[model samples]
Target chain A: MPPTSIKSRFGSRIRSLRDDRGFSQEELAERAGLHRNYVGGVERGERNIALENIVKLAKALSIPTRDLFTDFP
Target chain B: MPPTSIKSRFGSRIRSLRDDRGFSQEELAERAGLHRNYVGGVERGERNIALENIVKLAKALSIPTRDLFTDFP
Candidate 1:
């Protein structure tokens, strides 16, 4: 199998974190002030994900931006 | 004082890491397969910075992408 892309890994990371927080995609999107579809895209690894959006997600998740990348390969 | 933007903090982090690695902006850009001007813009906090480019820079720096956010506020 091809190695997982970092985007996929990052997306999985976000999904896992959202799960840990018991957040629905809509809730997370609301908290991040992003469109629900945009949040969905990021979680699905379909977005390139700019730093600003990353920061918004981190803020919404109540974690340091660095923590968003914890255990990353 | 106004709070520093995360973009600026991230940019400074990259610059500091580049300095620690003893790399000129051009050399680092070359390693990351990015344009020197683009790298310069990133370091200047003038770019929003996509995840793929972030990964490229992390690989070029021989660091985990998480390490790029070390000591982030």
Candidate 2:
């Protein structure tokens, strides 16, 4: 099995959680205090998320920061 | 209850993990491809960690990146 890339792993996990929470990308971005384009890049695995942003996402979701970084499957 | 600050949470988590592995700050920094000063700042809750660096640290520790972001009770 191929080792999962961090970008893909992070992207899929965030997208899944966002969808589960009924948040559109733009909505999530607003909550996380990030740009919509940046959020799109992250969901598409095109950008590297920063730790500060991760914290923001966690706070916005009312979850632990680890929730954003979880490995799916 | 006072909400734990993100800097403190992240700093403590990384320090605990590093200590558990018996790696010095310098050694961990080398493994994570970050500067010693940067790692020190992180451990001291004085730096904002980036996602790429988070990935690097996780890979160095042989743990999932989310492991670094966990909230310790």
Candidate 3:
């Protein structure tokens, strides 16, 4: 599989989680201490997200880091 | 929590996994297509690893991406 697919998969997962938690991109960005544009790009699979940022997102969403990775093949 | 702590926690988890899988840093680096020095840095908790690289490492380890994060609290 190509790297782009991996990123897109991750982005899709993040979006699903955000939606489940009733958070908009801007809300998630604020909670994660990331820029809204950056969060949007991540959800769009356009950014290669960093670990720290992932951790922030997980914490903001009150979920485990692994939860973001669930259902990924 | 500080970002450095998060990085270190992730590094510790990687090292534990590598040990469990009987992989040297060089071997893991080769498997992940990352630089050996970079893998070493990550193991030492000194690298803010990107998601793409994290996916590479997980794939190389023959494990789910979530497994790398299992013990992190």
Candidate 4:
């Protein structure tokens, strides 16, 4: 929407998923061993995280890491 | 090691990527329109972000969304 990067796009998706599940950043972070701020950055498409964390994120979020890219390019 | 979730895995990935790029959570958040805490959550593998956000994250991180899952299951 804003000529965003992968981070921004992923950030939007993350927010949607979180909202769909009625989860707060803090709640998700607690379960994922992550910081709420990091979740926010991801939602806003502001990060460049690595692979291992991707798996960690998928597990914590109850989604597969591949799911994060279910519709990726 | 912790049977971590996707969020945790992704969170770890994010941290590694950020560390690799020599960036702090705050720096990435500012660029991605995300909250730094949220970025931290993702790096710690704590969130179930959506596909779109994944793209944004990958972009912000200068990676392809598909690459996010380059080593995913």
Candidate 5:
């Protein structure tokens, strides 16, 4: 298994889920009212987003935040 | 509240619980068959230790792993 950071795991999970829904980073960011760069950083596991931002992302993406990371492989 | 990474929360909780038990970082690492530096790294939120290692730490500390991070403030 790849050595994964806590944020990276969450980010990877988010990317996987967003990809699963066929949503682009730009689209998801727009929906979440976050910057595209910020979304990309989040997806790449390069940022430590706030829990509030997480809630916003979850709400915009229509997925529970836990669901984004709980089942990561 | 300050933004936290997942592992930091876990590590802080571990430190708290270990302190609760009057155990030093070296003591806990020895109990868990982990290096003292590794334990320090985990405590400082600077490393992404494996799930297996987490399990070992939990077992050695005699606390459920979820208790380390769940209900974090």
Candidate 6:
């Protein structure tokens, strides 16, 4: 599979987790101290998000960083 | 704690995993299709490595991506 596939999967995982937490994109962005547009892009699989950002998002979502990779094939 | 601390811990984790696998920095970089310098920077906690690269490294190490975050505190 192409590299982007992994990104897309990761993005989807983030989106689903955000949804589970009932966090809107803006809410998640604020919690993670990121731009809303950036969070939206991540949800859409348009960004190759860095590890720091991943940690930020995981912290905002109150989940372990490894949770972000859960269910990934 | 500073954000760099997380990066530093992550770098140490990667470095230890690489060592455990008996892979040199150059070998791991080549396997992950990354630059040796980039891998070195990551191992030294100087790089905010992106998800694609993280996936590459995990694959190179023959471990699930979640394993990269193992023992992360």
Q: TM-score winner among the candidates?
A: 1
DockQ (C-alpha based) per candidate is 0.78, 0.49, 0.76, 0.18, 0.07, 0.69
Estimate, for each residue in A1-73, the C-alpha lDDT of model 3 and write its tens digit: 5554877888898898899999999999999999999999999989889998988989988999998898664
lDDT tens digits, residues B1-73, model 2? 9986677778888888999999999999999899999999988888777777888888877898767765632
- Estimate, for each residue in A1-73, the C-alpha lDDT of model 5 and write its tens digit: 8788756876887788789889999999999999999989987878777545765687778965444445433
Ranking by TM-score: 1, 6, 3, 2, 4, 5
lDDT of 2 by residue, A1-73 (tens): 9986677778787888899899999999999889989988888878777677777777766787777766632
Model 4 lDDT tens row, B1-73: 5675656656677777778888888998876678888788777667676544555677778876666665456
Question: Which portions of model 4 show Cα errors greater than 4 Å?
Answer: B1-73
Rank candidates, lDDT, best first: 1, 6, 3, 2, 5, 4
TM-score of every candidate relative to the true structure: 0.96, 0.80, 0.91, 0.51, 0.49, 0.92
Residue B26 of model 6, lDDT score: 98
Which regions of candidate 1 are displaced past 4 Å?
A: none
| Best of the candidates, lDDT | 1
Question: Positional deviation of A34 in candidate 5, in angstroms?
Answer: 0.4
Ranking by DockQ: 1, 3, 6, 2, 4, 5
- Give the 10-residue window scoring lowest on summed lDDT in candidate 3 chain A: A1-10
The digit string of per-residue lDDT tens for model 1 on A19-57 reads 999999999999999999998889888999999899899
**Which pairs clash in the backbone of model 3?**
none
Q: Residue A66, candidate 4: how far off, in angstroms? A: 0.8
Model 1 is docked with a DockQ of 0.78
Q: Between the candidate structures 1 and 6, which one is better when assessed by lDDT?
A: 1
DockQ of 6: 0.69
TM-score for candidate 3, residues paired by index = 0.91
RMSD in Å for all candidates = 1.0, 2.9, 2.5, 9.8, 7.0, 2.2
User: Deviation in angstroms for A43 in model 4?
Assistant: 1.1
